[model samples]
Target chain A: MRHLTDDEIQGYLDNHPDSDREKIRAHLDICGQCRSNLENYQIIAGQLNTDHIPALSPGFTDAVLSAIKPDTQDVPVEEPSRLIAWMSAAAVFILGIASTIYFTGSSVAKNIIALFSPANITEPSFVSRYKEYISGIDLDLTLVFAVALVLAVIALIDRMIKRRHKPVSFMI
Target chain B: MDDKTSIVRKIVAGDKRAFRLLVDEYQRLVNHIAFRMVSNPGDREDICQDIFMRVYQNLAGFRHDSRLSTWIARIAYNCCIDYLNKNNIPFIDEEFDETISNMPGGSITPEQQLYKSDISNLLQKEIGLLPVKFRAIITLYHLDEMSYAEIGDIMSMPEGTVKNYLFRARRLLRDRLMLKYGEEELRQ
Candidate 1:
């Protein structure tokens, strides 16, 4: 008795493979067990193909609607951390100023210390020679402030220039 | 309330009453989908509630570009997928054959088959066990009777992708039935 290979069976099931149909039929004719199993499988397939979508039970929708419609009494208070953001920003600005002062002070103090020991310097160490070349760390406070003031004035002037186009109401 | 635009108008006017009407009408459709996508009844209810709650919260952002039903359906679709992902369910890929070959077809009587089924019930179970997207896509297409274009719009899938999913979902079902039951059972 000839038997069908798994591939041949799958080909028939999928119905596309190049397996010769007569060969499969002949094998099926000879093989009782494959035929039986195939029959069982086909029956099960038919049973499953029935499209019976279940109906929604009574009040199912109402129950779901109830779950959705809760009493709106509990309000989640919005944690407005705007003040916290402002406070943190203010803290950083203060810290930035403090760090600038401390850094400048330390740089100047180091230069002063390096200069005081100049007698012991023949080929001045990089630190002392750097200080000798420039007593300060070359911080031009006036120029720096002047540029900052100019930027502020330019920004203010630009804002005023833009403001003139505003549709202002001549309310008495 | 069933008129989609009217519901939106009423809902926008701070009408809690309007919301209840929308929730009442659409909750079945939402729950039907949610229940099919996720097997747990409780989770289904939770997802349904969340969808309505979201409808309330994001009402302001909704433009009148689309019908309210479609918009709400899109939201419910998203909410179900989100719920599935958050719960660690895997998305189904159209990668493998799911048909079982050894189903008992001839041995069982047609009467037995009919008596044994609530096909939709078994269908929900099988569909739920599929890759999550398969279940959602199938439910959206079949139970909701949504057009491919509407399904695509709701899912944000390309129309082609939605069509492929619709085909894959049916193929998966056929394959699953083939594996569990045989070809004759299908034809019968």
Candidate 2:
């Protein structure tokens, strides 16, 4: 029989059935050189099996622990409630309008008062002045733009907060 | 829960003590893989620390499909590969080329070199001189006692490839041992 190849010997050593281990075994019984080769392979395998695993240096665990930031570092930032933010913006807008009316005098104030009073809404002078103010300012579009700006600011703040909570490695 | 699951859960729950336990438990495995892949002794500790730090960061994503050690080893293997790539080191696996110089023998005096002539130290030194892929296969198979399948997962190779690499690595190591120390010296 031909000598067992190194691969076959390795397979036999590893207990792989692909090697026809029994055939190699039988051959080894009759062949001195093949037996010696097998012995050599076994010795090498033995050394590898017994290879030393180097120990970690003292305080290695502590060193690793210290290197890792605390889990709290990754905690998601607490976002301000969106509803509360919107309500605060609305309150500020209303207060600004009320202060403007208070400072601008009774003519504009009466017009503003007339706009809120359903009974006086159809009075011709008050209605003409209110219509003039509405036509001049385009209040509907202004409200839409103001609402959009507030939403954009809220989204920007949300994104910044989320970005800050991203893992530190990502920043690096 | 099994010990691994318990440890993983605790770690995920933000337990620093459990994270410490994890580092204590797997430091040797990580260090072994790192030492085998990275020939520079100075880089091994940093690599190990980086591996565990990554594990901590990604702990929440680890599914229990494989052993926890296997997962950690996979991370270690990938980190070493990245390090090699970043440093532009070529990974040679097929034949042992003696022309390529081994890593510098940092801080080893002549006396230390003489004392390191023991078979084990010589064997380890030779293993370190091997290409990173061969060193990793030998480390996973022999030192870590990992199965070929697990090694395949860790190294991202097929099981057949894992077996082939294991056989080739051992044969190369044996040949190196025979050439340097002779058959008689190996018989010991």
Measured by DockQ, the strongest candidate is 2
Clashing pairs in 2: none
Q: Once model 2 is optimally superposed onto the true structure by TM-score, how far is the C-alpha of residue B60 displaced, in angstroms?
A: 2.9
TM-score between model 1 and native:
0.50
Q: RMSD of each candidate?
A: 17.4, 8.1
Instruction: After superposing candidate 2 on the true structure, give the runs of residues whose Cα lies further than 4 Å from its correct spot.
Output: A70-94, A105-172, B93-117, B180-185
State the C-alpha RMSD over the true interface residues for candidate 2, after superposing those residues: 2.5
**Candidate 1 local lDDT, A1-172, one digit each (tens):** 5566544564454352466888787777878877764554344334334434444456654654455434331222234345544544554554554456566875665666668766656754786578567866676655544554555455556556545544332111
Model 1 lDDT tens row, B1-188:
44777777776665667877877777766766676666776566567767777877777678877766678888888888787789887655656444444322324456546633443444444565566666666666655666667778887889778766655555555555544445544445
Best by lDDT: 2
* C-alpha DockQ for predicted model 1: 0.05
